[model samples]
Target: MSTTPDRRILIAEAALDLIAREGLRALTHRAVDRDLDLPAGSSSYYFRSRGALLDAAVRRLAQNSRDAFTRSGLEAPERTDDVDASARAVATTLDEMLLRRRRDLLVRYALAVDPTIDPELHALLATGLFSRDAATTLMAAHRSTQPATAAADFVGLVEGLVADRLIGARSRDGIRAGTADSVEQLARSIAVFLRGLPTESTGTRPI
Candidate 1:
């Protein structure tokens, strides 16, 4: 191939789509080339190795997630006092991801469970938009007494909610209910969780 950032990104994206549609076992340089309709060996020329291809895919996934967060305005400075708005913003972002970018999420889940994946790649997959650092920033902005712990819990809750809609028992129900219902329910759940956290103003123990 072409020596361009766009070309590399295109290849990586094709790899991710292949993984999402056919599972990790179907990911290969030849498969990616076939998916993109590129000549044989094109993917290999750029990626060089399976490990390098996986790394590129992981990086692409992270970039896509960050772009989604930025587009949703969630990456903006925290509002501090607007818990409801923040909750809704997060819910909206999640809803968009589920509806418009489900393939990315599916690929993420596939990589997350593969034992052969590199530790660094696994960590990159885990560090999503609602990562511990981002959650901690939100918690701190809200004046939570224990920002670190609260952030951990918040991230866990968000992950659980996403998983529920993706693979858990509620997956079918969430799908049938559609985007509007999912956003409303997710916003409500996030708002409740945020409000329940013990903040400096509340002077209550961490929950």
Candidate 2:
């Protein structure tokens, strides 16, 4: 690496890629160095310890997630008045996430499950809120009587679907093959939930 700040960021990103594809066992200084075609000891030189390297990867993942959501126009709702539109918009974002950001998601789950082994992983996941606030806001705009609860439910629904698909895809049979259709089904389910909710004038906004 060039020893610039950008180099550190790039190294961190490579660490994320390593974890995303090959699990945490693959995230070593030498592995990252080799993956990025850098000189031996380059990764350890930049991030002195394994914990430091993991922290950097978490930060990079957070930034990448924010950028992805912003680019997909899911950070904010476009047509708040139309519940169906919001559902489709949110569904589109979920689809993009599963299709393009699967690696990040895998890394996230690994960190979540390995927190006991690496306590820093817990703090790292805590710092990165996972866009829950945005989901709440979008649900609120759709006029949910309990936007916070509804948003939580909707987000949980999508998460379950993605997790299942990811697991199934890696199985021997590869039984789950339809990403677009899954996202559409999720969107339709969310729309149905939103449309069923009775509109209310006042409610506590999600924090």
Candidate 3:
């Protein structure tokens, strides 16, 4: 507790834990307070309304997601390369990330079905952070591609692929199959796209 300087992140993490263990319906102020070992007014102090709290929760989840992205080596130059080398590095990385994100997907799926989940959550789910826009922008920068539409398609492809794997793993069936060729397919798709581009590639993988 002494080491945690950011209470917002702490509160956000607590909320995530609650969602992970219970469900999105469990993300009330009372639940956050209980999870954080705080007094009754603690949650209200930080978030005066339910909307505020839920917004904070979404923001926190977003921050955590960005942190996880960088830490999972997605931002590393070696991993961000445009060729098969980077592809391999990232495939290995996403394999691990896919496993972790499976838990988040399960929690999110529970929220999606629950009528009590916040509207903000529904909004976020509708336009996810890994959306086609974000993915396109990022993939473009990563691959040095200029066509926004094409870049976004690759981004969408990656997002859809990752979501597919995560959803399957999160299913109650508990089967976590699909890999290797999946990565190869994605890499091949991105590579073919990049190869067709007018820009002289930096010898990187397409997506």
Candidate 4:
């Protein structure tokens, strides 16, 4: 199938949508073509096998994750002096991800639980493009001597909270109020967690 760069991205995004809404079983080349209203063999032309298509979709979602972080102004903070400000930035970023980019997060979470996607997911996370790496970088920016350890702890905390919310652990209110409350709670938790960290190798000055 003759394809352009744009069409490949579109097909990958369609795969993500299918997985997010209909489940991974529904992520077929034909299903993607049908969803996109493309020619019969279009998706197959670009991705000959199911694994190939899934890989493409996973990569696309990774790129989307990076884009979202950048858009939320959490890509990289210039200073680590103000932990509260940093925490708020992180909370705002999570609010954006949970509210505006929920579908992408769902796709990521779905892939996380799928053993078939484990290799691909591991590769993606290792690339410094997703959460673990992002969190590591964030900690390093704050001059944590053991950035990896801190990042792991912080990411685990946040991911657990998010997964709990996503899996119907709590009832959600209307979007605005829910998002605000979630962000506030995240910010507070993040600040508190950071404060609990050892201060020896951290650049985070005491407030």
The local distance difference test score of each candidate is 0.83, 0.73, 0.60, 0.76
TM-score of 1: 0.91
- Pairs in steric clash, model 3: 82-204, 82-205, 83-204, 83-205
For each of the candidates, the C-alpha root-mean-square deviation to the true structure, in angstroms, is: 2.5, 4.3, 5.3, 3.1
Where does candidate 1 stray beyond 4 Å? 1-3, 174-178, 205-207
Clashes of each: 0, 0, 4, 0
Name the lDDT value of residue 120 in candidate 2: 58
Candidates in order, TM-scores: namely: 0.91, 0.81, 0.64, 0.84
Candidate 3 clashes: the total is 4
At residue 166, candidate 1 shows an lDDT of: 82
As for lDDT, the candidate ahead, 1 or 2, is 1
TM-score, candidate 3, is 0.64
Please, what are the lDDT tens digits per residue for candidate 4 over residues 1-207? 555888999999999899999999889988999999998999998899998898888889889877776787666656375788888888777766677777877877777767776675657834423477778777776767677999889888777656656665443633342466778877888888766665445444455
Model 2 TM-score, 2 decimals: 0.81
Give one digit per residue, the lDDT tens place, for model 1 in 49-168.
988998999999999988877787655455476778778878887788778888988899999999999999999998864668777878887788888999899988888888888888
Question: What lDDT is reached at residue 7 by model 1?
Answer: 84
lDDT of 2 by residue, 1-207 (tens): 454799989999999899988988888999999999989999898899987898899888888878887797777665366766777776777667767887887888888788344665676564453566877777667676877786777667667766765664423443323365656765786677666655555443321
The window of 10 residues in a row where model 3 has the poorest summed lDDT is 168-177
